[model samples]
Target: MEKVTISAAAREGIGVKGALSKIRAEKKIPAVIYGGQKEPVSVTVSVKDLDKIVKAGKNTLVEMDLNGAKELALVKEIQYHAVTDNPIHADFQRVSMKDKMDVVVPLKLEGTPADVANYGAIIEHILREIEVRALVSAIPHEIVLDITPMTINKGLVAGDIKLPEGVELITDAEAPVVHLAIPKEEEAPAPAPAADAAAAQPESSSTKGKKDEEGNLTKDAAKK
Candidate 1:
């Protein structure tokens, strides 16, 4: 498991709101450390440093140096500015190295399924991450599943995934994460009706069989 090192100072003389705004102006993130039977502490960290940890895309282990007191923690939640997409605040859960904690980890799919390659089936990913419980140090960065032998109608559910030693899945075992199936194509629309059919055809017999008074009819009169 990779750990992120963050430097924080024990905040003083300011409320959370005031500190948070100041942190944001400095391009830092305001965070709170709670849990494990200690008084919650408010702190601030550089946005650049926090971004590196968040890019891992999961609840990651954090090594925080708070006013020279080091602690192990996990990122519990993050708040972002609705308009600017900047980090507004974050929460960290203090943890003991010996205790187990529930965390969500990313899922990585390996190898193209046989069905997708040989049978022209489509591979669908239903879930890209899952929750699990494990000791703080034993947490895995990602859970990888190989789909090399998968064929049409074959799938891997949460239960089918293999875990590293000491890690246990917390998600429903029957929940499907990946599957192979035939692709569905959209059907083309029917052709439109012709303009004649839509507007009604002209009356067909209106001029037929008319005659002139020469009595050979107009046809013989015109021959003269």
Candidate 2:
């Protein structure tokens, strides 16, 4: 895990309706740092810096320099603008190196399963992220899984994942992670216009000369 240092300044007028808007207009994001048994502190950080932290992936360890009072923290949560999809607010949780914390990390699959080419198999990635408990220094940025050995009708469960030393899996071990399935064969189309045309036709020349038992001229004969 890479530790990144970011600069932040104290924020005032938190409850003021437009205080956050004004901070955003200046290319700064409002944030709060809480937990680790200390009072939460409201602060503002550069939008550019916050974006870097986000791009680093979930549970990124960051050294927050709040006016020279350094604190080890993790990027806990972020709120984004619905319209622009830009981050508007962020939450940082204070942490200690000795404490074990549970955090969700992304899963990355590597290599193509051989069944995909051999039998036109489809790979389904059921779980994209997994929760783990570990010290801040032991947590990984992402978990990489090698799927090259998977075969058709085969699947991998959460227990199959390999965790780093000191990291404990918090997600259910029985949860499915990925599966390889064979593609279903498409059914042939039914023969169109299935009704028999001969049976559906009205009486034709074959029946024109025939008369009924009543001895009255048949409708076709009368027309003739």
Candidate 3:
């Protein structure tokens, strides 16, 4: 994958309480670059630039220009504000072009499966991404799979994907990536049982006592 170049400035006072907030107020977010057998460096990058990379993909290979020095890295994690949802901080893992690393690449389906139209089968994308081991330069931004020929009940597993040369799948081979499923018919809810009006009604207090043929309450109960 081609690397995207982004500019960053070295930052300090990471332990200071308001230091991070001060960076954000200036339209930048705090970030750190670590790994690759080097000491971690604290830095800050423009919020706009970081957001663009995030929107493209987290696995996007980046070339961080820290002042005059250049470093290759991958966006590992991003912390967001709880209420505003804005990015608060980011972690970038330093990478080497010569070393093989495992990274997740997004999966994209190219076409509708045959069964979708012929049998009304629904296409289920079981795996949205897959982990693969490859050199930084060989890592793919996304993997596209063609599903046009698939039929109902048919599926494509991770092993079925055609990886680019030098890229090896790290995910399980048997793990499902896409499947054409039969749509389930929604059963009509059972009709509620008819209510028995007489059984449901409570006996009125006025009619609680037995009456004689003359329609007068029994004398024995009336006395009570």
Candidate lDDT (C-alpha), each: 0.82, 0.90, 0.88
lDDT tens digits, residues 1-224, model 1? 77888898766646545765666788877788999899899888888878988986476788999988997889888898899888888899999989998888889999997667676898888999999999998998888888897777668899999999999989999999999889788899989866774236433353234445532335543444
Candidate 2 structure quality by residue, lDDT tens digits, 49-154: 9988878777789999999999899988899999999899999999999999898989999999988998889999999999999988999999999999998767
Highest-lDDT candidate: 2
Alpha-carbon error at 213 in model 3, in Å? 31
TM-scores of the models, in the order given:
0.78, 0.88, 0.81
Which is better, 2 or 3, measured by lDDT? 2
Clash pairs, model 1 backbone: none
RMSD of each: 5.4, 4.3, 6.1
Model 2: lDDT of residue 160: 91
Question: Model 1, which residues run further than 4 Å from truth?
Answer: 16-19, 185-224
Off by over 4 Å in 2: 202-224
Shift of residue 173 alpha carbon in model 3, Å: 0.4
As a TM-score, model 3 comes out at 0.81
Q: In candidate 3, what are the lDDT values of residues 1-224, reduced to their tens digit?
A: 76678999999887899987789999999999999999999999999889778777657888989999999999999999999999999999999889999999899999987678888888889999999999888988899898898877568999999999999999999999999888899999999999986468754676564667775668765765
- The order of the candidates by TM-score, greatest first, is 2, 3, 1
